[model samples]
Structures are given as structure tokens and as C-alpha cells.
Target: MSIRSGLFKLLGLCLLAGVLVAGIMFPVVGAAGVISNQASETVESMSSSLADEPPPLVTTLTDREGKPFATLYEQYRIPTTSDQISEAMKWAIISVEDRRFYDHHGVDWKGTLRAAISNSSGGDMQGASTLTQQYVKNYLINVTYRGDELGQQKAQEASLARKLKEARIAIQLETKMTKEEILTGYLNVVEFSRQIYGVGAAAQAYFGTTAAELNVPQSALLAAMVNNPAVLDPWNNPEKAKERRNFVLDKMVENRKLAKEDAEKFKEEPLGVLPGGPDKPASTCVSADPAFGFFCQYVEDHLVEDLGMDKDDLYTGGYVIRTTMDRKATLEAKKAAEEEVRKDEPNVANTLSVIKPGKDSHEVVALVANKDYGTDSAAGQTVYGLPYEVFNVTGAGSSFKIFTAAAAMEQKKYGIFDTVPVPNFHVSPVFNWGGEHCPTRPSGVRTYCVSNASDGADTSMSLQDALAKSPNTTFVILEEETGMGPVVEMASKLGLRKTMASRPADGRQPDPDHEKPEYSMSQKEFYGPNELAPNGRGMFTLGASPVSGLELANVAATIMSGGVWCSPTPVLEVNDRAGKPFPVKEPECEQVVPEELANTLAVGLSKDTQPGGTAASAAAAAGWDRPMIGKTGTTQFQGSAAFVGATPQLAAAAMVFRPDIPYGGLSYGGPGNVHATANGNMFGGMTPAQTWFRAMKPIMADLPPEPLPQPDPAYTKMR
Candidate 1:
């Protein structure tokens, strides 16, 4: 024999002796890390981790109706208990993988000795790992060294030292866990196919059944695949998989786990796997329905940011998340949005959000966008969370007028019926025009002047009438009359907190010429004590800042709920793997404004869909006769348009803007020319209000119309 061969055999005998000692002494000396220096730390550290750490499992997200729509996972695994596994599955795996599983403590010493001698002789290297040893190895690879490629390789390396390390950990595991638990853990953490892990997920993927329901033949096939999942995959190598499966069945019979006659009969049966292939369930927001994908992404962000959940745990914690998404409502809203602004309309995007209003909770029911939620930008699909986020949409336009009106009423200085001047154009005395070329006053100050949407609004009218017409000059004048601070504060209080606090990264860079670059900040910061545009400016009332469509809908919800501001939450419920209720962390509902002020504001805004109102034409077209309050907003340059409305039950906001042109405005007659003119057709009342009425008409069809609260005479009448 060669010297190398002699040395290998001698080393193998030494390892065999070490393993024998470890098998007997591991329970006592194992705690002291007396195993070899190379393996002591690895075995000791990994043993406790195996006992303490649970394997990565799948997390499912369901709609409000409790139908699962999306799944999130690091490893596509579903954990099952010993009782949840079938007897056939346990026996088949043990019979083929380790025939003397129950007879040995953890390591089968006789098999190990034989494998050691054979391997040392340079024949086909064999694995003598018991189920517990395999469990420890799998746990180390999947859980302990999940992302560490080097650590995974070390756990799987083919060496006597590695085997000794595994043996020591396995013996320790046997003392801590039962045989059934070890079997279950091994079955769960083992890979059955690409991205498919665990017996539970395997059963569902292979046979469209649960682990507990797996029959003998099905269990045998899965057990056989654990040896070589890629090669033994039934979909690709059916003949080989069948042959391996039959071998497992024969071994089961030899072990007396299955009857010989039953094994023979089962061998003739075909692999009854689910049709087409393994039923690998699609995961992540990208795989969700186009109509609901945006909302699914929104819920994911909300869970991490507001609920304080660890992002990694969210994917592997096996949580069952029940969200407030009304699938039907979401589908309908998406259909309406796409119908109004076709999904193929590349530049423009129409976004909508719906909230169920309440004093304690404002449940977000729907978030829909005209564009399909996906990564294929060329196909008119977007991955941006448009409905819930500000994104590239310019501003909410005259939507800010709602806050101004609310602020005015809250101050008790101006009532809804109190007359406010409406002129063809008005010059502001308090605000600077900045870079805009405005007419210089006699004092050489550039006057900030603004005009109404149309050329024929030179008359004084009540605040309620002015809101319906949405005269730009009136709201800007009102913002000056009512301090800008209160108006900005009202927007924050009425559910625009996130919108006002968002510091968009684009266009915030400091001047290149400046010695110190000033970073761009959020609207709230601009209105605060910051040196950049402190205390806000004149255009605040006209909604000249980017805003969240979801929060705008929540603004209507806040008003509909009589001044209570509740953070809009998508999660309805969450349960841990143990099926215990997980508490959701959300901002508490607070009364931001007086109940009477909100009620009075709602009554005044109710005229928006009435005769001669801006949204009157759209409301009439939709046959909208329900008792509702609404407001329409069109940006100064027609960059974006928005409509916010609410009933007693539901509140919604819809906006239309050019997503591609963040710093630019949407012209009526722009490229793609679906429906545009130089300055004729793009107004909040046109597309956005039409979209709102089109969606809300069907949503509110079955609900009874509830009347608004009586308007407070103090806000309705002049002080």
C-alpha cells in the first residue's frame, strides 16, 4: 500500500476513536468544550443555536376577506410539528437515510466506522450521519450561516473533522430534543427542490396537500428527493425519481415500517404530483395582482416603519398578516383609474386611495394607480408606490384650499358663508414672487400676483361658494388673511403629516456656487424655523407642494370622522407562528380640530357636487345624488389635478399628473395626446373628479346615504 493510503487509514481509526468517546462523553464533557480545539467552539456554539433558533419559515399576506394573496420568505419553508407530519413521511425518510435511527443515540457508530474505513481506503465516500446529525448540519447551514457562504461551506465540508464536529453537536441535540422533534426539524430544514424547503412546503408544492395528509407513495418520493433534490426532481427526471422512490419504499418494508405487499402495490402507482410541475407559490409584491401590488408594497413598508418590526424577521418569521385591503374595492378602483387614464398612457398616471373613516381607526381599503405595478417600465408598468407615496407627482393643487378653509373656520375669524373677494387677478402684499417676473410696485418690490382658473370670476362670494369654484386668488388671499402657520398646521393635523414631513431628495441640492451646500428639506421644515422658506409662503393654500394621495384621502377621513385624526393603517391583524395575536403599533387617534369645526367644514364642502359647482358636471354624469362633501384642485400650471371627497362611510382622494415630469407641469396638449389641449381640458374637476365619481358611484351603491352634521352657526355666519 502507498504511504498516503496507510496514513489515511490510521487517521480514520483515530477519528473513529474520538467519535466513540464523544458519543459517550458528549453529555458531560461536551458542556466544557473538551471535544478537539478545532471543533469545540463550532459544536458548542451551534448546539445551543440549533435548540434556540427556529428555521426560516414563510409569511403570508391576506386581503381583508382573509384570502391569501402574497407570500414573503427568505427560504420558502413552512414549519410543521411532529403531529402535523404523517407517520409514512417519518418512517420513509428514516428507513432510507438511517435504518438504525431509533436504535442509536444520535450517531450510528457501526455505520460511521464502516464509512470511515471505506473513505480512508479512497472508495466511494459515504455519509453515516444520523437524522439528528443531519438536522444539526442543516440548521447550521440554513439558520446559523444563512448568508455567510464560507460558513455554509465549512458546515458541509467532506472531512473527518467536520463529521466529528457534527457528531458531537448531534449527541448534544439528542439530549435536548426528542426523536420526533429531531425528525421534524431535519425534514423541515432539508431542501426538497430549488427554493423549496421543508416537508410541509414540499407536500404542498409536489402533491398539493399538507404534510399530515401525505400518503405512502407521496411521502416516499419526497423522502427519496432529500438525498439529491436537484437530480431526483420528479419533474425533470421522472424515471430516476420513480426508481429512487421505489427503493425508499422497499427500505421502508425491510424496516417493518410498511408492509411488503403494500410496498409492492405502491410501486406500481405513478408519481401523482400536481399537474404541470411543482406548485411553487409566487412571492413578494412583484408577484401580487397588478391592482393590489402597490397596496401590498405599502403594507410592507408600514409594517417595518410604524410597527417597528425587524425587516429580516418580516420575511422569515412565518407571520400571517391580515391587511385592511378590500380586494373588491381595490379592483374596482383600479379599473376606474385605468379606464379614465389608460394604463398605456406613458407620461400620465392617475392614482387613487380609499379609507374607511372612523374616530379610532382609518382603515385604508384601496390604493390604486392607472399604471400596473411592476418593473417593466417600457410596458407602462411602474414599481413606484404611487398611490401611497408622493413619488414624482408635482403637487395636490387646490387640495390645500381644504386646509385653508379648515384653518379659517377653526380661527372663528372667517365663516364658510362669510364673503371673500374673487377677482380676475390679485396681487399679494405679504409674499414675494421670488424668481417669477411680477409687476414691480411703486416701492420697487416685485408683487406676487395670481389669477383665477377662468377669466370670468370677478365677484365676491361666500367661502363655501369660493371652495366649489376653487378660485386660485381667493385661497391665496385667504392664506395671507389667515396666518400661513395655522394653514400649514391644519394640513399636518388633517392626515398630511407624512406628506408634509417627506424630504424629497431631488431638487434639494444646495447651490453649486455656495461655499456650503444647503440640503433640501420637507415642506414641514420649510414652514418651521429653518432658514430656507421659514414659516411657509403664500402658495401654501394652493397646494404648491408634493403630497401623498393616501394621506389626502385620510384628510377627508379625518373630517368625516368629526376632526379625529387617525393614522391610516393597512394591517387588520397579524399572528405569529404560534397563532398568537401580534400587537400592531400605530399612532393613536387624536382630535386635531374641534368636532363642530370639522362638521361645519364638511357641510360647507358639500356644495362641491351641487349645481354650478366645479365637480357638478362629473357628478351629474355619474348620477351621483348621494349626500357627499368634495373639493377639486388644479395646479397653477396644470401640472397635477386632484379631487378629495367623502361620505359618512368612505373617504377617497384621486389625482392625475405626469409621473415622468417631476419638475415640469402637465399641459392639456402634451405628447401622447390621449386627451389634452393647450389650456382647455385638464382641471381637477375634469379627469380626477370624473375618476372619483366613476369609482365612488359603484362603491357607495349599496350603502345608505347618511346626512352630514348640522353646520355650526358660528362658522356659517360672519363674526
Candidate 2:
């Protein structure tokens, strides 16, 4: 060939290389006077603007003691700095993927020229991407183009434009970051397997080790997966995986990262991975440890509903959530609940909630249920939010009588020690009942009438005595005289806000024509003539509406805190992705009722564990001898029952109900929802009171015995 023809051919090859480099290599081609001015301008016009945000990282959830219990994430990645990574991992990856990683700025120019010439001759596409270029591509795909499928595809496409863009941005990145920084970022953002990213997660998932502890063989096996993770997966294709791993070991030997003898010895060793990979943490709240699952779920709900945080941020924003969940308290509560009512019991649920009382704010420590928190129904696991949610739960029964009592004292019309008539049966002159649940009179008008739980308690007694015995007729008449509106409002101010504001979810929209059409059930009951009861029945004191255990526990907290009301906060602190304090909307605490009235009421409630109280039997069975306030309640039709009580330190509530059949009543000594009981019937003083005593005995073992607040003479005086 002629010398001129040889130089022309070489020049043609160099110009073809400009296509991949966006004409950044035009200076070398321009020496032969073969580059166009338009191409030179195109190279100068290409921009490099890479995002500087860190990749998605795993969010951790810690308990009351700041110990990690769960992890939430969109991608299972734990970002590690260069110093935290082992030297074997760094050298092995460099040896197999990019041999001249430290020598090159961002792109391997010599390799690019050779690949361009080979491709121009119709050869297959060859890879010339340096570590920095690979880092740029991964950063765009995982962080910048996140959730944008088209943008992610465009970033990874094997086109000349994509390569040119990556090369330009990588060169700019090299200017800003050191070679070690580039390598660290690349290892942190690269996808080692489906849904698994970064060397930290990869080491744990594959070999049950950390990034800093990876040895030579494990490092070689991981480095081999960078080229094709799907094909070289050690779990599915072990032979191919071993072959690729040995190839990486050979490269490590050639690059002097490992001695030849050590490389060969590594080839003889087994894969040495855990049998089925490491045991990953519960990725979601439903899969958390049964002892802490419900509390974890409550934290999630509080973040989203109460604090106005985005639901997606829990998994993607890398927050460090520190919650007020006491592990010992929660486990004790769960054990007590399950011990009282077995988890596998048919159609029954037992839930317990614990709250720490404070004058300013209340802190929730435990929320537990007899059923395990999971998706498996056959194994007695449930994913329903039974502890926190009020939906589909049966009525709170006479546990609501505390609200009526509080309302009477707040009005200064009745004192706790005042005399009230308790009849065997009394008919209401104010309200006429509806068809099914009550009796119809001969005049075609059904007057509301109720009887006491025991015929012996028909005589007149103090309001404090009525509360301890929980007679139906006395509280029913009390509701009539105190006015249902004030009673219902008092429940809202105390803690039953969500329960009182709930409406049936039967596709019922608000009435467009009525004033304040979006009123809740409690509002309708107070205003009179609601959907269920015409002229607004007097069932408010009897706990006619569904209620939340969490709210009931907070009610006890309110009384124990001397009438102060506070939002039941689960989170103590939350740090954002950048480790800064994330501000949440704080609801101010207020004294909902007078401190004197609350303290007087607390004294009135303190007699429940004494001689003639409803919960006396349960308390005695547990060897109880504490100064505490207690109340037990059973729904009129045996649908549900509850026990709420408080000490100077902690307050709690426990309930027994039919979760599957929300409105179904419990049957005893026959074929019914709840089967095989200690007694022929189930009541608030039965399972619920027992559960509370069993749970609180151990929990209060270490707490010092403290007396409740003193009653004020103004409210304690009989009317």
C-alpha cells in the first residue's frame, strides 16, 4: 500500500472514533486536517450536569432504647464509605472490570480508539467504559431516573449518544471527585441482584458478611457478578458462577492483587455461602417480630396520618425513626393477652394498650393483641390494625360511664359521692326505642327501659358506688339527667375523638341538603334524630358506639394526669435522610376538664378493686393490692366487654370481642361465637379484667407504689 493511502486509512479510523466521544477527540483527528467545524462545535455544545444527591438507602426503626428492630427500604442498600470496605473487594473489582482504573481520568482513550476501529469494521460492540463512566450510568439509573422507566432505559441504552453523554459527565465527575470516591460511589450504587444494591447489602445477602469483612474468595465471587448478575447468580447457576469467579481470581493474580498460589487455592475451595443467604430483616411492618409488629405499624400510621408525613418516605427517605415502644412492656402485654384468651380461639380477639401518664403529654409504650401480626390467617396471624383502629369493633360498653361521670362533675350539678336511685328496671320518659333491639309499647311507642346487672343492687347509692358496681339502670338515668350532648362532648375532649367521629362505611355520603351534613355519629346522637335512633336514643352512657383501645387507654391517662389531655405520641424523635431533625406538627396539650373534678373522679373510681367492685374477683385472683382506679363493662347484648384502669404510673385498657363478626353477640353454654369459657357467659369483669391485672402485675413490679391524687371537697361533697 502507498504511504499516503496508509495515513488516510488511519485518519478515517480516528474520525470514526469521534462518533462515540462526541468529537472530544477531534483535536487528534484535526492534526490530519480531516475534522469538520460543525463537529467541533457539537463537542463544545455537549453539557455535563450530574445530580449530587446520595443514592436511596435503607431506613432503620429503633425501639424505646434506640435499638434497631426493623428496616424499611425501596432498594436493599446500605451505603458504605471507602474506608469501611475491605481492600480485597476494591482490588478484585478493579482487576476484573477495569484494569487501568487508577491510571485513567474517566475514559480509556486507547481502548476507545481500538474499540471504535473494530466496530467500524462491522465487529460486535465492545465495552470501553471506565469505573467513572459506569458510576455515572448507575447514578442516573438508580437515583436521577428513579421511577421513570423510559429515562432509566435511555440511560442504559447501548447507543452512541448515551455513551457520549456518559463519557462527558464522567470526565466532569472525575474533576470533582477523587478516584477512591468514584469507586466508592460506584460500589454503593451498582445493582448486584434484583432489588439488591451496593457492596454492603451484597456481602450480607450472598455470604452473610459485611463489606469490611469480605475475604478474597467472597470478593472474587461478588466482583464476577458485576458483568451479568442474572447469569452469574450463585444461587441458581452455581457452575457458571464458579467459572466466572475463577476467571476473576485469574485476573486478580495477573494484576498482582492476589498471589498465584492463593488464587489457585481459592479455586479449590467451596462457594462457602450460607445455605439460603442471610436472614434479612422484616422488610415491612407486617413481617416484623410478633412482639413489636403492631407497635411498628402504629408508628407508621402516626407518621402518615398524625404527623402528615408521606407514606412513601418511610421506605425511601432513609429516616432514622426512634419510637417510644418499650419492648419489655409490649411483650408482657402480649403474653398477658394471649394467656387470658388464646390466640387460636374462634372468632375472638383480645387487645391491650399501655400509655404513660403525664401532666402535659402521654406517651404510648405498647399496643398488643392475642393474634400474631402477619398475613397468615390459618396460623392465627392477622394484619388488621386491631390495637389502634376503631373500625368494625364492638361498643365499649359501660366503660364509657366514666365520660358521663366526668361530664356531671364538669357541670357542677352532681358529685361523685352524691346519691342516685338505682331501680331494678326503669322506663325512660324521654326516648322511644326503635324496632329490633328494644321492647315496643302497647301504644305503638317503645319507651327506653333498662334493668340492673344484679337484682341486689336496686337500692339508691352514691355515684362512686354506681361506678364500681356498674349498674345499668343508675347510669342510664344519669345519662338522662346529665344530658347526652355534654357526655358525648366530654368523651371527645378526653380521648375518644376518632371513635366518636366515625361513621359506618356502607357507601354513605354526607347529606348535601342538611346543615353540617358531614357530622359524625357522636354529633348525630347529641343533635337528636340520627339514622339509627329517632329523637337520639340515650345509649350514649351505655357505650352504644364502637371505640378504639388506644383511645380508651388515653382516657385513663387523662384522668391519671389530673384532667390534662395530650396526643398519644409514639415517636420520640425522627431524623431525616440528611440526619437533621425533621419537624412534625405538634398538637398542644390542654386541660380538658378541671383538675379538681378529675382528681375527685379518680378517687371515686379507686373503689372498684375493693369489696363490692365488679373487678374485685379478678384483682384478688392476681393477688392485687395496689391503690388504683378500675372499671369493667359489658355490652348489653354480650357483643363485647372492656376493662380500663390506671395507677399513678401507667394506664391501660383491654377488650374481648368478636373480630370476624363485628355485631355478633357472644353466646355461653351453647353453640356461639366465643366457645368454652371459665363461666357460662363473658363479661367485662371476666376475661378483660383478668387480662389487665395479669399484664399490669409484672409491668408494675418494679414501679414504686404511689397514691392517686386526693379528691377535692368541693366535688366530693354530696349534692
Per-prediction TM-score: 0.89, 0.88
Tens-place lDDT digits, model 2, residues 1-719? 99999999888976776566554443444544344455434433322333256788778889889998877787888779999899999999999888999999888888776766766676534477888888888888877787899999998876666666667667767877789988998999888775788899888888888999999999999899988888988878889889999999999999998999999999999887778744456678887897788888888888898888887777888899898888888889999888877778876788899999998679998999888988888877888778878843556688889988888788776799898788887788666655355677777787887777669725888889989988888877877777767877888898986776664221122244545423333433443445545445576677745678899999999999999999898988889888998887658888999889889999989988889899999999999998999888887567778899999899999987777763333333222235433331347887889889989999899998899899998897657
Looking at model 1, report the run of 10 residues with the lowest lDDT sum.
671-680
Best by TM-score: 1
Where model 2 places Cα greater than 4 Å from the true spot, the runs are 1-16, 23-51, 110-126, 435-445, 504-535, 576-580, 662-681
lDDT of 1 by residue, 206-227 (tens): 9999999999999999999988
Go through the candidates in order and give each one's C-alpha lDDT. Answer: 0.82, 0.79
Q: Candidate 1, TM-score vs. the true structure?
A: 0.89
